[model samples]
Target: MPMEKTEKTLLSKKELLEIFVNHRVDSPFPGDWESVFKGLGYEFWALRELEPTDSFKNIDWKAKARTGKFFVRDFLAESYFNVMILYDVSRSVQFGRKELLQAHIAVSLAYSAIASNDGCGLILFADDIVKYIPPRMGRTHFMEILDAIVHAEPVRCGGTSLGPALTKLLNEVPESLTFILSDFLYPLDFGYTFHHAAQGSTKHEVKALQVLEECEIALPPGTKGILPLYDYESGRTVSLDLTKWQAFNDTMSRQREGTRTLLGRAGIDLLTVSPADDFGRKINSFMRRPPSTY
Candidate 1:
């Protein structure tokens, strides 16, 4: 049965902001906060003796209590991170009504980063880039990001080229951390793109959020139907023969594996989310997971 869309099923921007803030503050992060920041290229400096006029918040109470010495924590000058959200607005993303969830995830991440004082940017694309918002900080900039996602529409082209968009990103924001949200149904060679982005002077951190439907994996038992299967982008349609469904299933499996292999080889983190899952909790855990060398 197809899931029914509801007001409660989709979150408002206010709710999304609340969830992200709560997760960052109340939920347990996979590792220490300092470690998480460091993994994202944040710099940390050593602690020094506390000055008499230093704020109490900066003083080390334990060190002061242990000895007669007052200690204060010091840190390197922190710069706002360039967080770019690369969303694939291709027609395939609408499958199983997953577009709302995708949008929610994208907005949630962008909001969370902006709340952390990071400059957030957005790129919505299909065959070509539809919209590009350069990274910036402030409430007005964050609201523009929300508006961009809410008003986005996919292009009617028959193909998607992630390479070109990624190329543009490197040229524009070389030291960015890019989050790519897509179904990755394109036939183009993205492995090469991933390889290039992960290497050289303009190296940027890439993470993938794959949106998929359950029907793509398995059909219900005793299912009897002849459905018109269509590739929204390519405009290719075929009759799905229930008796020969294994062929279709095999193809989807291969595509999933191929996407995973390409990202894994490039040391990119990939997280798959389905509409049926608890999206907020699932995404929070993913964002909070301990970073690996991969």
Candidate 2:
């Protein structure tokens, strides 16, 4: 169920497991998710940790950890991967291009992670993490997660509040093999919270990757006259004069620079991708050579 409409389930653990597993085995990924990944890489999955509920009484929502070995014949290499994905459910993610890419890139990457035998899970966050799914092996777990992610719903409307979200991840995420997927609008204290979380427990293992949209950063010329933009969730609209494109461009540049600077100071492994860009290649290129793994 989407966070916007988290549904109440009415099934037993055995029933849920049976259905989840059968779905995976029958629906083997359409793409050869394993081929793209090279050598051994850590896969990160953000999981929800919650009490047993009616819908999924059998579903285990904890940050469980595991290690596995795999060998790629073509690469003539064997390595280990610990991978997880942390996604922001903030209203900011509800915006333009960046939002679409999140659905495409993040979801695809998670599949690759599972194929690599790397533990993968999901992190659903707003002002705070709503749930944590512990990373584990098996096709059933992976497919179930992929389904949930593909169906994530919008939460409450609020200006990209990530401090609480990061805090939740900090408290629960098992390791650094985690890959953060967000626009990272860069709010105050949010950076500090993320930095502290990165420094806490397993330091330097967590990596921050930014997903952005092209239009937000730059605009085409002749997009003249007055324009208005509205928040997807809040429905708040702001008017802008087309003649100010140049100024808007300049200001956006400054914002980008500032975001990069702050992220650098925080020592976060930073990556920004646009929706127009080749979503898969960008992520594969960076992860093809992870700095380290557990």
Candidate 3:
């Protein structure tokens, strides 16, 4: 018998989109999926009472038959879309094995947004706002945003804060789709800040992409040794005994649950992906899916 060898080829943007369209989640989050991925063109409005000037092509005959009333489909022409990408460049992101993965995810989404004729913006933040590239349409602007994020320097700070950066975004950009990408390992009080940020967005939808390392998610069951962990953001060093390590893992578990709860309550759609998962598929799952109305 002969041996078989396989070569892996890189997937193009078109191929990635095909995968998304061909395969859908079991139960998609209820949202306006068509408007989110289709970019600028026309949006389907609710079926309403037919007007004298309404075209026959736009008429919803099924609705007319079912409800026993004349109704016509309405469409609103949308010129363009503004997609704001908020990526965390705190030192903590630079510490793990998946250091560059976060940027890759951000870059992918940014590419998709721009390719779809939407204005893509970049906001690199840590404890404070590091850099802000206002949303602009075109390949050149998207490339500039990508370059800034890929070459960004990690900040040395005590912790990550979304309040100041989000507050700034709320004040500057209006009616944009905001994407916040981070590991989200922050202090307890930061939750309040998150709630405040989400609450303040009146006309925008917030999509959260949480990047986490495998170890951060959970430890092996047999792990029973002392461990040395470093806080990259604060430049602090700490030694943990076996008991303390378990407690730390417990705290991380609780934090994950708390984060899910907080974001859910704020009506934010969260997609948690890890380095171990298929990056393209996971990203497509998040970006291409319908927004959650829950």
Candidate 4:
């Protein structure tokens, strides 16, 4: 039997959505949310919330006894922080104008979060911070987030610069459950940014949900022509020999692999999402990976 890898068959949005709705992650992450998130694999997520007492922060309301030492309390029977998703609306992610798909995934995350009684929000970025939706736990709130994403205009000013945005978003989410949905194909120093977020984190568990496309992972078998590629950021156009398609493919593969490795090292959960299959199933599967031992 052949491996059932998800392939991009000739299916319209409606057709693929039908398959997704019929199968895939069963949650209140909204109908379209599941489909979009499946394309990015940011469907289900939970976080260990740190309350005022459990956060190891020293607070002396009375200011008496001169006890100025931080204390680390136990769970104290507190509630868990649900989910929040940060979609990558950056330029590099717009390859073939697919960032629109990522936008849909962001909405799905919001719906899922609200459905789970968790707070959901958005962090849209391109080169710099574009928008930030504060996490709120409510069905209606999730709907608003979805509406915002759906009606968003494309950021014609393209290119991805993840480091700055990651740093800012980490601050916003604090220690909440953050799922970064992005292609992250930028030539920036994201390692330091992620490292800082991890080391300086005081409130949330962050996960890296990488959205990948089939065409990006492997190129079609065509080589032997002039290929002109334009940089969305610099507006610089460069022409390359199509004969080097094999090398180009290899480079892309390496870049993606390297990103996963770097994210893993930063204590971030890495889930691969594809644009070629039932996004809901893929998202549900990825979120539920490495079965819990508890």
What CA root-mean-square deviation does each model show from the true structure? 9.9, 13.7, 10.3, 11.9
User: Candidate 1 residues 1-294, lDDT tens each?
Assistant: 022223357665455555544554432211122222233443546566865434567677887888878886655324667778998888887676567777776776666666667788998888777889999986678778877887677677868878767766877886677888887777644544444444777757777888777677666655677899888877899888776667777778888878777776766667777767665555544544443233
**Against the hidden reference, what TM-scores do the models get?**
0.71, 0.67, 0.68, 0.65
- lDDT string for model 4 (175-273, tens) is 566777777776545654334344563644566767776766776787578878876656789987768889989998888778777776665656666
Candidate 2 structure quality by residue, lDDT tens digits, 141-202:
77677666656766775555656655655566545466678887756356542354456565
* Global lDDT of each candidate: 0.67, 0.57, 0.66, 0.57
Q: Give the CA lDDT, 0 to 100, for residue 256 in model 4.
A: 78
Q: Which has the higher TM-score value, candidate number 2 or candidate number 4? A: 2
lDDT of 1 at 20: 41
- Across 1-294, the per-residue lDDT of candidate 3 in tens digits comes to 011111122233344344434665232211113334442236776787866544567679899889999987655436576788888888898766344666656666676666667788888888889999998887678668767865688888878988776776777787577888888778423332223356564555677788888778877665677778888976778876655556768987889878876776665667776667665555544543444443
List runs of model 3 lying over 4 Å from the truth: 1-79, 188-202, 241-249, 287-294
- Worst 10-residue lDDT window for candidate 3 reads 1-10
